[model samples]
Target: MSTTTSPSKHLLELQGVHTHIGAYHILHGVDLVVPRGELTLLLGRNGAGKTTTLRTIMGLWQASQGSLRFDGRDISRLHTPQIAGLNIAYVPENMGIFADLTVKENMLLAARQARTVAQIDEARLQWIFGLFPAVQKFWNHPAGKLSGGQKQMLAVSRAIVEPRQLLIIDEPSKGLAPVMINNMIDAFAQLKASGVTILLVEQNIHFAKRLGDSVAVMDNGRVVHAGRMAELAADEALQRSLLGLAL
Candidate 1:
């Protein structure tokens, strides 16, 4: 039940990418593909280099070898700001919220094009509010005061504060309750409907199964499996073999 997507249709591609952090080599010739306008899940067990892969894509970590392409253009040597300027937004697992800033201020800061809340697109703001009501609820509250789940929502809200070509999020469902996870799922569903390509690093299989259109499972810094989400979701043995857990 595996599925394949043409390279031309892929918004992001990595071929033989390798990353080293001082004395440690993280990504070992990793190859990954993310199709346009679909959610692709990057799944792996702990210490499998999932976060390292994301950081490499963001130019937060320079690849020592291999090529990285976005929209068919070479971006392997770009700096973080340059990479971000290409309309790719990244939300790290730490959530990256400014604790002392108000929720509205955080959103405003992420919107580089907008200097004021009034400058933000009214309709888009409303859409984001619909996606995560907590953002709207805590608009004036300090981000540090929010609960874990609420802060995660704010982080996502900040990333989407303005439109972008791609959204790379690390574990949006991490540390969330079942009810909160459902809310996060719904928000992502709406985001997908908006036709934005997403690359998510998720350890939550339930979250991945529910929203992932394509999946690439990593181990020891390389992609060991790639296919349609439904295919992996339907095969319990494949799940166990690749992820070391049943879906």
Candidate 2:
């Protein structure tokens, strides 16, 4: 007799997603699933459409085909803000900080958009500060003045200020020093420990191998391999074929 496995505990799923940027079609048909309380990493070489997949999921760009399901409900074509309102947060590569605004102000902007903003609670703010003390220290400084790592922290903090079902992040370690990357990884780990589901698009294989609960490898806009993190890390030849990297 065979036992059937249950659906994921968390609430994010992408099925046969196809996306196009301008005249170019990037994701021919991609499928992704992220369980709650797990860190799911999407990995690929440059131009593999890793970031584009995140955009399509966030509804920044409409999907020409397939379904995006959150909490077992279909949300394939919802507006961007609408998707955000459903407790899914997105932090893109640029970090989207307000250059002229102070660190506190940028957070405040995100706070106001949250359902609990009217209450002005500091619990989440305090938690954010605890996760990234640098933000607390730079509260009064313009967000533009922060280092690359600090800005990435601020972006992530802002995205998660609200209670979210899914947090989608793009290239959190991109363009950061070794120390900053470590800091970001620690932050992500902390987030995972809190039982928040994360779907990340990352290029750093080492980082992905360390934090990813499951790995999805993409190539030419298609996901070529999906498996356990340890399986990929242990196979050298698979790494070369999928990522063009020996390690």
Candidate 3:
């Protein structure tokens, strides 16, 4: 006889989470969930505490109160590096690429298991190149020299340099041309199909609706609505009420 264990339905969960930045309370009891192998979108207007929530989850900002659980373990008290060590990757709104370094060097730095370019897994690197051709095209070029869309691609490619259990991305499609945004949407769809859980803070309603399996709308530091993306996408009245615009 043999027995097997089952994985948790939710890969990441934040319950009643609160955060304060120098006496300014940000997250007001944020409750969000990222289901295993699904893409969850965090949507809201400016100053809605969307980025703050992502920062808190990544341990960049400590949650003053409440619980954050990752794969059934408490992570509210963990430090930034420690949280990242659990195979979680975060790409902030700024993209966070090393501008001074060559694209190849930046990628090499992201690969923890590889000390040199030659040591990186060839197959995986090729797969990333396929996902973002600009990263390959600018392999030896300084990251700062690339266009905005290229930089965003490089940032995402760097995050997936090694296998990640979860990806927390902030506005991957920001400041891009329509063509580039569509390209990004395609890349993200492929990434979702590859089985990594994703949490995104996106202002692009089209991108969010296209790729999100679940949706959470935040306002004034609180999550005002949470449900299936399709349900929200189909309901214009609810969208206007929660997001102040129809999707």
Best of the candidates, TM-score: 3
RMSD to the true structure for each prediction, in A, is 4.3, 3.2, 1.4
Per-candidate local distance difference test: 0.95, 0.86, 0.96
> For candidate 1, lDDT tens digit of each residue in 121-141?
989999999999999999999
Give per-residue CA lDDT, model 3, range 103-165, as digits (tens). Answer: 999999999999999999999999999999999999999999999999999999999999999
Of the two candidates 1 and 3, the one with more favorable TM-score, higher being better, is 3
Model 2 per-residue lDDT tens digits across residues 1-247: 9999676674787888899878989998998878778999999888998899999988899999888899877889789988888888899998888989998788888875555344546787788888889988998899999988889999998888777778999999989898888888888898999988999988777688879998888888888898877888899999999888876
Identify the runs in model 1 with alpha carbons over 4 angstroms from their true place.
1-7
Q: 232 in model 1: Cα distance from truth in Å?
A: 0.6
Model 1: lDDT to the true structure: 0.95
What shift in Å separates residue 185 of candidate 1 from its native position after superposition?
0.5
What's the distance in Å from true for residue 50, model 1? 0.3
Residue 147 in candidate 1, Cα distance off native in Å: 0.6
Give the higher-lDDT candidate: 1 or 2: 1
